[model samples]
Target: MNATDRTPADLLGSALARDPAHPLVTFYDDATGERVELSVATFANWVAKTANLLQDDLGAEPGDRLALLLPAHWQTAVWLLACSATGVVADVGGDAARADLVVAGPDALDAARPCGGERVALALRPLGGRFPQPPEGFLDYAVEVPGQGDRFAPYAPVDPDAAALAVPAGSAGGPEELSGARVVERARADAAARGLAPGARVLSTLGYGDWAGLSAGLYAPLAAGASVVLCRNSAALAPEELARRVASEQVTHTAA
Candidate 1:
């Protein structure tokens, strides 16, 4: 692959080189009154552990589908990059039955029950809390990820032309497939179109099921060397609270 044929993992590596200490993902959960910030290095560490779990523990490989039934939390962002690092195709909001693995948020447990492959669940609580009792038929993400090695080394090279993402059904009139190279290209272009300045801090309240949402939440910010303040349940916040968050976080851009 050419140097220009970039993948999501490549973008993260560049961001770490540019400034590892800079905040890469600032997350807010309005319903729970939770706020968390992760620097590039910290986020990369999480990605590494998650990637190792996928490859070493779950035996996931390139072309294998991982259904991601998650919300727009910091952990979800971590999983997205983890999938990229391990060359697993992320099927956002896809049917669990058709996937090689199913990762579900707490609210999606019932929906994920029928998946035939490995199953993982995230509590999405503060500080990566695990479920009080592990969900039946599912491994808790917070419990499992921390125990994995912090450094990731894929068993094989990932193809830049291989499928990387599958958008949710009805998005872009139907599901859309994006290759690793195309994912990066679209991210950079979207960042440019949004006028994202280098190292800018952007706040977004978009889900990860569609192209625009995924770009704004993760890829576009990384592509522009910017950071993301991902807000979940933004609808539950008042206008004053939203404004206050933006001001407090020093956010330079907004996406909804």
Candidate 2:
């Protein structure tokens, strides 16, 4: 697929088509010493299903704010894609402040409720064992996903000038809003310039929440139909572990 024909959804679809069975994301469960792998097809399907759930089940409309506070797990990828597919404005919020909707880990959810209260409409808890009880009106994400349809109709063509993400301004007292279409276009161009192509694997020492790292590490490779090997906090990993993961994953590029 050419750059002109690709959308965020199409990028994921291409990855699924190219390497349906290949592991797209791998994470270690420290408690069990178990490795969890999410394949390209599974990732794509969850993204689509989440998009449908947000739009159809939760009544999230285009331009509505959807704040994400989950860890850098497989679900983070799903939330990013689902927001793009449904045209909901995705905001990466810190532990404080109120957002229209919040997707968080159990601890974050509890902290947010006292701050946000009735202002928050939806509280999506991550899928795992022993999460905090959501307020009476909040919904369970695990149950919500199964109830949603398998697919979602794509949003109308996105406006290049419209705000798509609002990133927190590091201790600056305000967030920096960005244009989605512009970011996507620049990412595609950067990917092409860097020779990030299909089948190649890219790694990032920075977290996915960083603007440049997120664009280059996650979206850029996906835009080029390449695989991404993401580490939430690469700086925390031991040298041997990092080297082993890079070699095992066959990472070709590193963007810090």
Highest lDDT scorer:
1
Q: Which ten residues in a row are the worst by lDDT in model 2?
A: 117-126
TM-score of 2: 0.79
Candidate 2 regions with alpha-carbon error over 4 angstroms: 5-7, 17-19, 28-34, 94-98, 114-137, 155-161, 171-173, 190-194, 233-236
C-alpha RMSD in Å of predicted model 2 compared with the true structure: 3.7
Query: lDDT scores for all predictions?
Result: 0.90, 0.65
Error of 2 at 124 (Å): 11
Worst 10 residues of 1 by lDDT: 168-177
Per-residue lDDT of 132-169 in model 1, one digit per residue for the tens? 99999999998999988978888999897999988865
What does candidate 2's lDDT look like per residue over 28-82, in tens digits? Answer: 4333444556778877778888888777666777777777766555567678778
